[model samples]
Target: MDDDEVILSTPEEISAMAEAVKENLLPTKSRRLYEKSYEKFMSWRSEYKTTSFSENVLLAYFNSLIGTLKPSSMWVEYSKLKSMLNIHHRTDISQYAKLIAFLKRKSEGYKAKKAHTFSPDDLQKFIDNAPDYTYLLSKVAVILGIMGACRRQELHMLKIDHILDADNTLVVNIMNTKNRIDRTFTITGKYYKLVKKYMNLRPNTCTSQNFFVRYISGKCVAQNIGINAFGQMGKTMAAYLNLPNPELYTGHCFRRTSATLLVDAGGNIMDLKRHGGWKSTAVAEGYVDNSIQNKKKVSNLLMNSIEKTQPHNATTTYIPETELVPVIPAPESHQKNITPTLLPSETEPTQTPLLSQIQQDSDIPINTAASRNGNITPTPLPSDTETAQTPSLSQIIQQNSDIRINTAASRNGQTITISHNTIHNLHLHFHK
Candidate 1:
């Protein structure tokens, strides 16, 4: 070693080198904490700092030989030390190489699997049973995503005016989209009317010009309803519906479901891509693949094949009724025993003779039972004087017909007797 080549051995020289590393901390949280670690190293170096000491001396200081900073803390400290000395200073710190490698090895251990996408049935249940607000949000999200294949962020930026056309067709301007391209999506009959209603009723104001404005303090504002808000709403909706764990389907699932269902419904893949502003056909193709797989699964469950066993059991087991069951009619063969009956009100003669007056005054002429439902043959009425004298005479003529009157009681034996009226009493025959 040449005399001109300076060797860093003095306590002050070693302390200054460590302090330089701490002062030049990188831009990240825990930078202050890591700087303290460097300061501690420098303080200890005053008593033991030396250029001749092997890499073991540096490891002892880093591992905190005086204290127990195991596994997690040790890795944090090791990373900062290595980053500052090796990366920043570009120093050949060979001693700490093994420690750095050891920490990285542990970090590469098994990471938890990410949550899976929503199944078709599960998604349907979640949407169908979601709370009012959440249901509306989910519906709009699905329709927009499926029709236009909208991203979560794109949906956040959607304005009411984006949906165009007087007809059912919707035209979404893609300037706010991820790809910055315009596209139009056709709304189906089920969703078109609702989307139209929502657009017309959306909050409007001067301060917030966004289509979906938030109502704050009874004033409409252009504050963005976060993408996370939609996700959180979904979670709340899932809980309300009592769905399975991880019931909350994220916004991305809406996009996936839309693509899958559309293709399954015989939508043109090329057209779907164009309207969705997709740069390539990969995503569209994936939708088709997933659809086919789902179709196969459903078909396997529904189809009854003589060659194959049933998906469910063939035996029908009856479950005992735990609650009261109301008796319902069975499809057994029987005749209904019915008899002609009349209410007392219907059979009894009215004291006021209201029925007789009603019959005489009615435009529809009443007929006897023998003539009912048949063409009536009218008989001429008796002379006016005879008819006028017979108010109660109609009732007697309807029952007893052999009414005799001695003409001697009137004048001489001239016998002036005549029938005045005729009435048919349906009840009289029943009584007899």
Candidate 2:
């Protein structure tokens, strides 16, 4: 075959090439998990011959792991096994109704507990307790993992060239992330200083291009740190700090802590998604939901900021507690003498009465002589025909000389006169 020409392959070679391509399509971590899951299944199959790629066997296998493994781990194992079986048998095991129902029931009944995240105080304590130069790499790893919101694999895979200094901010270019998408985040404040310190102390004897290397006996031993080793450093730091359940704070705690801190600081969800390389807002929301105290703080801020105050002229009155009094029943004699005052009829006074002017004017003193005698002679009102024929006030007084103009105080404390002709003029003047 010529060097530039492609050779025709046999059937076995073509099949091998197809299998290799299919395996390469899966991520490295996922392919390893599938292989491990298949190995465990094969080991179980040796003891139980009836165990095959069936729903019953799979359910039984999951049930066996209930007490030993966590719900999340068991679910992952089941997924891996299902995927492996599907690829090998060319059948979709996830499509089985019974298996899907069983998985749903298991998920609903069993909730996996998450690990405790590191707070700012906890991180500070861990950094302060660094014993030697070798462990400073661990400190740098943790700081970068938290400040960049990077996973363990991403931290381990960071290369020296990925760190770019742009003025005061240091930019970290993260590759080989869980989502297989490249993301760049900036580090400023104290975290930038930490990265610079680690770089200054980096072992010159190590020929690795990777940013983080494994240091043994004050010398760099490996080109890059392993994922397990990076995670173990988190556990070690937690133990050194005497944190609660040190084993629970893994390398992933950095990512969780970073997301929680950003949200608590009022970071936008879209910005968080881009910063953390999250595929959906739901993931960012989940991280924020874990921050119960921050949620309560935000709720209190909203309640206080948007609170409405009562108007200055509001009718409602607040009685002081000390001035509250108890009521006592009146005696029978007092109760009988207390008569309810009748309210004036709605049709009684659409317009003010003519005598109301006398009551309003302080210059016009009320005559008390007739009121004291309790004799209020009702003044005869003018007939409607006489009212229409009546002239002005001066003319009425001039024409009616025999008319008795007696001033009697009415019940409403106003003086009334007994004159039929002058009544129409008073009514019109008062009403107008």
Candidate 3:
């Protein structure tokens, strides 16, 4: 080959290039989905027998499917068609802005219903009632599904060689999962014993290497179980148990129930992600949220306390029932001879006997004046005594405004004075 001349590729080189391109193609399962979607679309629009795909035709087809299919299902079909077109014609229908916008707007506010989960009790009941060999298989399946948190596909792919016994625990090797990543889990407790027993009873005549096999007509059949078979098993068990809404339970229920149970048992999100083989935290979080005890756990954390303390006592003391009853009326005869005392008029400044300075100084009796209507008034102080000029009531109040008094009145431009003895009494009364 000359430097200036371009060399033509050899047949081997072209073949190698073709092989490399083929290596980039979708997996077998994914290709099947694209093929199924394309065939369905073509069949629906058979009248338009064009060899090529058109954006208008796809839009019209998807629009017609709006009411017939759920948003999620319709979106799946759209995705498959998009992938098919891209692979074959090197055209991406999803690149059309209008189609993308339309699908996005339509899918908004759409939620898919989650599969129902079976309680541990219901699963145990199904296991107990399962007939003989079937019981062995069913018990193992339930154990693997619940304890290993295996998906139906993962469970189907399990082989007898994948399970290993290590002292007290059984290890399961999972392969070809939804995320195409392989993982292993160690299971222990009662589930480990059940798996061991199942292994012991597993038929020797079984031809298939798959751990879970069918027992029909009293014979162990070696057949690779499909995903649907797992779902059917769930339905069968539910029906046998006479459970309500048996249709709600499916193979996926095992995975969901396991995740929920782990979350309820206080398994952390990161640990749950690893146990469930989830590729994203969002998926793990969703399982945690769906747990029946999710909100209950939150409430317990927020409201419950472990420590106990004394309860608060009421501010008021409890009164006895007898104290609540009224006292008997005093005899009417005793009230007839009682004499009424006469209170002095406001104009009378009557002088009362004042004891000697020593006696008066020792104990000053502050006499409160009673009105003609029997209302008590401020005590009138003896007109400024020689030994001690009594402090005016106003001055006393100003000096100790913190003390509470009923009432005080002024008359004839004279302010009543309360003696020191009165002040001391007032202090004691307020304190009491």
- Alpha carbon deviation, residue 96, candidate 2 (Å): 1.3
Error of 1 at 285 (Å): 4.6
Worst 10 contiguous positions by lDDT, candidate 2: 402-411
Q: What is the C-alpha RMSD of each candidate to the true structure, in Å?
A: 24.6, 16.2, 16.2
Better of 1 and 3 by lDDT: 3
Instruction: Give candidate 2 regions above 4 Å deviation.
Output: 1-13, 39-57, 64-68, 124-135, 214-224, 239-241, 298-432
Query: What would the TM-scores of all predictions be?
Result: 0.38, 0.61, 0.61
User: Residue 218: error of model 2 in Å?
Assistant: 9.3
lDDT of 2: 0.64
Error of 1 at 58 (Å): 26
What is the Å distance of residue 254 in model 1 from its true position?
Answer: 1.1
Better of 2 and 3 by lDDT: 2
lDDT of candidate model 3 versus the reference = 0.63
Q: Evaluated with lDDT, which candidate comes out highest?
A: 2
> Residue by residue across 1-432, what tens digits does model 1's lDDT show?
222224634466666676676556564545777667666655776667554323666665655542465455666666666565553345445555765565556556534232234446765665455443425645566566656666677777776667666667666664546655766666757567655555554554434445554433333344657767655544554455565764435555556556666666667878667756777788566544345566786687667454356334344433344322222221111112211122223322221232233233321122233233334433433332322233232333334432332212222212222222222332232235
Residue 165's C-alpha lDDT in candidate 1?
A: 64
Which pairs, if any, clash in model 2? none
List ranges where model 1 is wrong by over 4 Å: 1-134, 215-223, 266-272, 283-432
lDDT tens readout by residue for model 3, 1-432:
212223554466665675468446866667677777777877877866765466777777889888888888887887777776775556788777778777888999987777677776787777666675555666677778888788888888898899889998998898878887678888798778767766665677777788877755445555666768887766777787888988877778788888888877878888898888888998777765355567777777666563233243433343344323222222333223323222334542432222122113222223234332333334433433222134433334435533222112222223333344444444443344
